[model samples]
Target: MDNEGVFVTKRSIKWLATLALSASLPAAASTCGDQGVWLQVLGSGGPEVGDQRASSSYLIWHNGKARILVDFGSGALLRFEEAQAKIEDLSAVAFTHFHVDHSGDFPALVKASFFSPRTAPLPVLGPSGNHLLPSTEQFVTRLFNESSGVWPYLSDHLSGNGAYPLIPHELASNSTQPTTVWEGVSAKLSGVGVNHGPLPAIAWRADIGGKSIVFSGDMSGRSGTLEKLAQHADLLVAHNAVPESARGVARRLHMPPSVIGTIANAASVTEVVISHRMLRTLERKEETERFIRDSYKGLVHFANDLNCFAVP
Candidate 1:
């Protein structure tokens, strides 16, 4: 292996050119079936601007209806509409972190939901905060707190005076074990703390209709907490933000392909979906897939905006 831990071969040059060309093409139309649980990629790109794709967001569909939302990054609102999802149909919304790319469009979603028919309190769950980050409740309060919030007009949502109140649930950030955040007749949600450098972050798992799907968020994989939450999951949505050669702060914030592979392998997940694509990792798709395959023998899919996968 090279210094960056990337496997270097004589065919690397030829492969790079081919993979880059493929990466530039528009993603093919992929839609999930209508009969069971489905995962839809709302925003496939990361925090970058040039990718044309939106930032990180995801939707979980159960029996043709959107049941849960995993994140609401930039441009995700538009994608949600395009996917024919209804805010009223969502049982809860879980965030991986409070990063702009992961939660920037939250207020926008709340604003849009004003027109929806949902009357029940919406459950919003996220990680507990440390000194560097605000807790989930604090994050929501700072956004909609009546007196000092950025959107004071919409503060009624927090005060139970709006169309529907928002109930914020904060998962402990120091715990590696999964903690249940929300539970319903057919759906149960859990989360665990993850390593995202100094930022407070967590990964989410949803169990619905006898199927399990885990979102890895933007973890660096150093905490080793994801394995327990993702164990034996039907689908794992892992972030492929940086290449194996990435180092310094980039390495500290996001997991490389090798770590993703190891986690999926160790967790024994059925399939892996890699999202949070950035320009840096887009052209290096082949190399990333190669490293992930080095450890994980299961299915690996590179995510695209609007791409859908049915849980089987």
Candidate 2:
């Protein structure tokens, strides 16, 4: 049977009915509400911008303090500012990969750091480098080093006299399993490898104040890596770039709705937030939700720009 036909099957129909009923209720705000650990969707769109979803960036707040900024994609800086996010409050920045759509805004963010009064060097984390792709350390250095790069204005600030500094940290390529890459402010950042061409991809799992949330950074389908890292997370933010009907091209770099559902089901995450929507998925939101609901029995939410999810 074709994918569309399967979605209309009795089981899927019942699931959709349940989803319709559940959608009427207010969604859970957060996993740690009193502790103030919350998630803000800076940009919900993918590489393409149709409905103004801002690529794939998220801001995580711990105890009303900005603990981490995850994946600063293109135009994310604008979205962050629009959301009233404090760039200086960030303890660390974690990049899932070096894709233009995901990490393109890093240089701009670094330049903006100069205007802030940050005394400590900002820690930036990402995968190890290869000949083609720069490691997290090299990526940051190339941007601010005195020799060459785009932001020469940052040279003085990066050097002496209480300038804004960036401390680069590279996550070992293909680490055996998920491990802590950065930890502070009652939060821990850990990651697992994901398939996104030869560029190398990663997914982050953060534990903030005893609550956990996972972000799947553009994986190739529903792999065990995602399930293992996201296992039992309070919220699993999965990418929904293509519909189940999409094939070939999308299967290589992105996951369809069904794939996301299966992974969320396997991980047993309490809630599944669909993000990174491309032009196609943005126009067909209901279709994507129905496709995912067919296999996954959990709360499925379609995230939008600036939408905040409060952690319990």
Candidate 3:
């Protein structure tokens, strides 16, 4: 290995030791409470499964209430249950795009919400469709509409007093800037498009209790648009799907650690939490941290399944 690789490996060993020590400590009380907003990572892995991390799903709790669910990837439904988060309390569900790894569990979540006792409509937000891609409205319609969908059984049930209604909103594709998706309970939601293959991907930003947190759905590379949308955010949740060494191929579908770091740095975010890891990223955790630390001079964390962080 080269000098940089060797340094990274050494750092990895140190971090692994630290992680071991941290795990040995008694389980702390669930930090989520009425005073602060807490973010629980339901799934931190990518599409692959070698590392045992679940795919992308996040539970954002504001004032001790589950307020939003960002992304619903594979294995997320079970992870959500494991986290013991209430789907009924969610004010909105936002999708970065239509990619399977980022949205595979959506149908399951909707089905579960149908059985919950939520009396209000759950708003769904996603990217607008182009000629090549279906809009968020079309996507939901293709799944839950009455005439032609597998979940048509839900159509009648979701409308009457017995069922939970779903309100879907398709974000404009050509929006000049960030646009609001939902607002309530001292929370405001907005989104912006980012690079993620041909699919029209969106990055969501939520403001709660005067703090801002941005989730960069799946981006193809570092995005100025994302930086603008995430400016001065207290936390930036970015996808760390590949290592810096795999930059060449990863640039087409996901962001490398260095690119993510640059975006976090440019956005002036106070903390960067890297999620969406695959086997390659899991194996080179130190390398990813080192690359990010090189550009971002802020708190950086590698997200794991069931990991929780608080917005102070």
| Winning model by lDDT | 1
> With candidate 1 superimposed using the best TM-score fit, by how many Å does residue 172's alpha carbon deviate from the native?
1.0
Q: Candidates' lDDT values, in order? A: 0.88, 0.75, 0.77
RMSD of each: 5.1, 4.4, 4.8
Report lDDT (Cα) of residue 55, candidate 3. 84
lDDT of 3 by residue, 235-297 (tens): 999988777866555678788888888898988999777888788777786678778867886
TM-score of each: 0.91, 0.88, 0.87
TM-score of 3: 0.87
| Highest-scoring model, TM-score | 1
Off by over 4 Å in 3: 1-31, 157-162, 174-176, 247-249
Q: What digit string (tens of lDDT, one per residue) describes model 2 on residues 186-238?
A: 77889877776565677898898788989998877534688888889998988
Between prediction 1 and prediction 2, which has the larger lDDT? 1
Model 1 lDDT vs. the true structure? Answer: 0.88
Q: Give the Å shift of residue 234 in candidate 3.
A: 0.5
Worst 10 residues of 2 by lDDT: 1-10
